[model samples]
Every structure is written in structure tokens, then in C-alpha cells.
Target: MVPFGRLLDALSEVPDPRRAEGKRYPLAPLLLFTVLALLSGATSYRHIICFLEQRRIVLNALFGCTLKRAPSLNTLRTVLQMLDRDALEEAFRQHARDLLPPAEPGRMPVVALDGKTLKGSFDHLNDQKAAQALSAFASAAAILLAHTEIDVKSNEIPAAQQMIAELGLSGVLFTADALHCQKNL
Candidate 1:
């Protein structure tokens, strides 16, 4: 795992989408808090908030969190909704790249590609199905390289193709499900 301070530095440049006048917390710290909570097995906004609340003392001592109180679930939801998705993804990828060891000379990385429906994502109130995402994993390193969401109207085939191509892998061994072994691909 990357050092927490380095992680904070990597995320410091992310643009905050909140109005300046109403900004209660810095975007970098808030994002760091959320990511830390997620890494600790927080799977929902409520869980993340609770994690922050419970670990407030330790977090403040370590990271100098200056929050008067833990952010509410609504605040977290709004910030997440308004966050720049592309910027966040790029930051995450850069951090992951820093953590990954360099490939050996004349050796290619082995990457696994797959798609899975996100559990507990079904929108029962809206009568919508669970969200599906295509992911790329560096096999040896056991870390996710990247991912893309499958459009609601489309299947994994197209999403997988786009994700693999965007990865710009060269001299790399790509493995995937039978669905991606199309003759045209």
C-alpha cells in the first residue's frame, strides 16, 4: 500500500466541485477519508460516515483532519455526485502505477480482463437492474489496473473492448472470458 501522505499528495490536485463559500472541508482530505474508509471495508456512504466518526481521533492525529464533525451522509452523497469522475480515475490510476513494480526487461505484464455485475446495486425503487463494470487486473501484482462501467443499453463486449484498448497494453498477455474471444476481436 502507498503511504497515506503520498496518497494525499496524489489527490491534492483534484478540483473540488463544491461552491467555495459553502466549502466546510477540503476536497483532498474528504476524498482521503472516503478512500480510507472504503479500503477498510466500508461499502456504503453511511458506513463511510460512521467509520470517520469512529476513527476521528486517530485520523485527526495522523492526518490532521480539522473537521468539527464527521460529514453527514447527504454531504458525502452530494460531493460524490458532483466530483469529477475522470479526474478521480486518473488520480487513482497514477497512484496505482506508482505502487506497481516495473516490468522486467523483455517481459510483458499479464493482465486479466473481466466483467461483473455490482452486487446490491439493483435500484428497486426505479425498477432498474444492477450496474455492470469491466475491470482490468495486473495478475502478478494482484492490483486493479483500470475499469469502465458498461452502459445500461450495452453488454460487456463493447465495454471490455474499450477498456482494453484504452489500457494501451503492448507486449502484454491479455486473458478474458470466452465472450471476448470473438473472431473479429
Candidate 2:
């Protein structure tokens, strides 16, 4: 596998004002990229560091850097928390779009929608006003297409509509349970 440093070098082609001079570490993009890479299969931070260290030779050959150590976990967390979620989401979307195969002109993709609460990640800090999310699934590909957060007291109808609106159903078939049969939905 190509080392993550190499990947970071490639991504660095995109200019970011956030990368100003005198910064202690390039944390946001580095942490975000590292997390995503780890999620893909990198075992641990040490493993990532080892990978990067090996690629350091290559990195120095391409772009000069005097780095010798991988970032600590605490550093990674601090950097990631500061990252702009919308920017990260947009980057993810663009990358996903690029990875997708071209769709045939006449072929309509199948889409399914549904919602469920993530019981494990539930939070109750706001008590009665806490937000809750329901997930919509595209059954054919078994991928989650969209999600909507419902108010604690609100029903699923509004959330369903919000999720549906985010999906592109032109020629695509949508399937859902009776809960989604509401007129406004």
C-alpha cells in the first residue's frame, strides 16, 4: 500500500488558507486524513507512523521535510475537533463522486429509504428537547443514503421528508414503510 505521507502530499496540491506559516502542526487535514485512512484499515497510530517513516525517504525526495516522528493521539484529536465539518463533508462527497462508476443514461438506480435511532450513541443532555436521528437506507446497495434528526417530541414524518428531499430519485424507485405514507411526505 502507498504510504499516507504520499497521499497527504498529493492532497496538498489543493491550497488551504488554514495552512498558514508558524503553525505548530498541520493538524486538521492531517488528522482528518489519518482518521479516514485508519478507518479504511490501518491498525494503529504506530503502524501509521511506521508507514510514514518508511515513506519519509520518498517524501524528502519529492518535498523537503525534517519530520522524524508521527503525531500523538492527543494531537490528532485536538486537530480533528478544530476541523470544519462542512468542509470535510464536501471533500468526502467529492472523493466519493470521483470513485463512483459512471451511470448509464437510461438506467435508473434503485433507492430505498428508512430510519432508525442509534440507541448506542443516544444523548440526553437536553432532556426533553434532545435531538434524535433516523437513517434512510438504499436497500439495493445496502448503503445509507440520508439521515434526518427529529425533535424529541416530533414524529418521523418530517424527518422522512427531509431525508427523501436529499436523495436524487429521478427514475429511481423509493421504498419505505407505512410510516412514510403521509400526504406531505
Candidate 3:
């Protein structure tokens, strides 16, 4: 199973004690949609719904969902939009840790940090660029940790430092491209 899938499973296991239920979709179905979205390169909620409709049976079986009904695009959009992004990130990180092999004491992990652009999806109304900074997979036991958006008028050094600081790479070796080789970076 993929780390993201395992993370979703772990997250689904957490009981919601709140008496006020917001939505009604089963955890398995939601997870199935998430996995399908990732696999099909669907970056938006609408795309995920379309992907789910096409692979209904396979997804249902993969996620162990017993739902007699299929979720609408609006339903999925509302549910996903309301979810706490921080909680989702934490779940993904925890599952990533679980999937990683045990690190040897003397052998430090090599983390390659870099940034990227999303190519599209920029909100034109807000005048925001569509650059999505991401941590690319470099090697086993290591990750390209964080990224910062770079615009025409702004520099990324400070943002990169902030990201690196949050990563807490005490024993690990960090490497980046020439853009990240600044004196303070």
C-alpha cells in the first residue's frame, strides 16, 4: 500500500466524538477518492469526482467501502474543502515515517530541497501566481523537505530558511540547487 493510502487509513480510524455530523460519506469511499485522485493526477475536487465515477467498482473494492450510493461532485468538494489541511499533513507525515526504513546512527540521511511551479490553477482574480512549491522524492530515507514561492519582485532565501528551520534537520545533510546555495541559506 502507498504511504498516502496508509495515512488515510490511520486517519479514518480516529473517531469523531462530535455529536454534530457535517457529512455522511463513508471513510473508505473518501479514501478511495483521494487515492484515485492522486493516481489519476487530478489536482482538483471536480477531477477527483470524475475519476471516481469511472473507476467505481475497483475503487470500492480497494478502499473496502460497502456504500450502495455514489458520492456527488458537490458532496466530495464540500467535504474535502472543510477538512483541516494541517491534520491531513500530519497524517501524511506520520505514515511516511512508518513506511521509511530505520535510519542507521552513523549514516545520515541526504535531503534534497527544491521548489516547483504548478503551471496552472492560479487565481486570476486574486492576482496570485500558480507556483506550487514541493519537496521532490530524492532517495530512500531522504526527502526534498520544503519549498517557497518566488515571484518577480521577491526572493526565496528567507522563506527557504523558515522552511528548513521547521524541518529540524539536526543530523541530516541538506543539499539544494545553486539557487539555495546563498551564504545564509
In terms of lDDT, the best-performing candidate is 1
TM-score of each: 0.83, 0.58, 0.69
Residue range 8-76, candidate 1, lDDT tens digits: 877887789989886997888889989999999999999999998998778877887687778889999
Off by over 4 Å in 3: 2-5, 13-21, 27-29, 41-47, 54-60, 104-106, 121-138, 141-154
Q: Summarize candidate 3's per-residue lDDT along 1-185 as a digit string, tens digits.
A: 46556766767753432335754666544754666577779887778777777777776676566655567877776666666665555555545546666667888776666666667758799997676564634366654333445554555555556656766546767666688766763
RMSD of 2: 5.5
lDDT of each: 0.85, 0.54, 0.61
Ranking by lDDT: 1, 3, 2
The Cα error of candidate 2 at residue 104, in Å, is 3.0
Clashes of each: 0, 0, 0
After the best TM-score superposition of candidate 3, give how far the Cα of residue 143 lies from its true spot, in angstroms: 5.9
Q: What overall lDDT, based on C-alpha atoms, would model 1 receive against the true structure? A: 0.85
User: Between prediction 1 and prediction 2, which has the larger lDDT?
Assistant: 1
Q: What are the per-residue Cα lDDT tens digits for candidate 2 across 23-80?
A: 5655433543464457657786666555555555554454455455556665555555
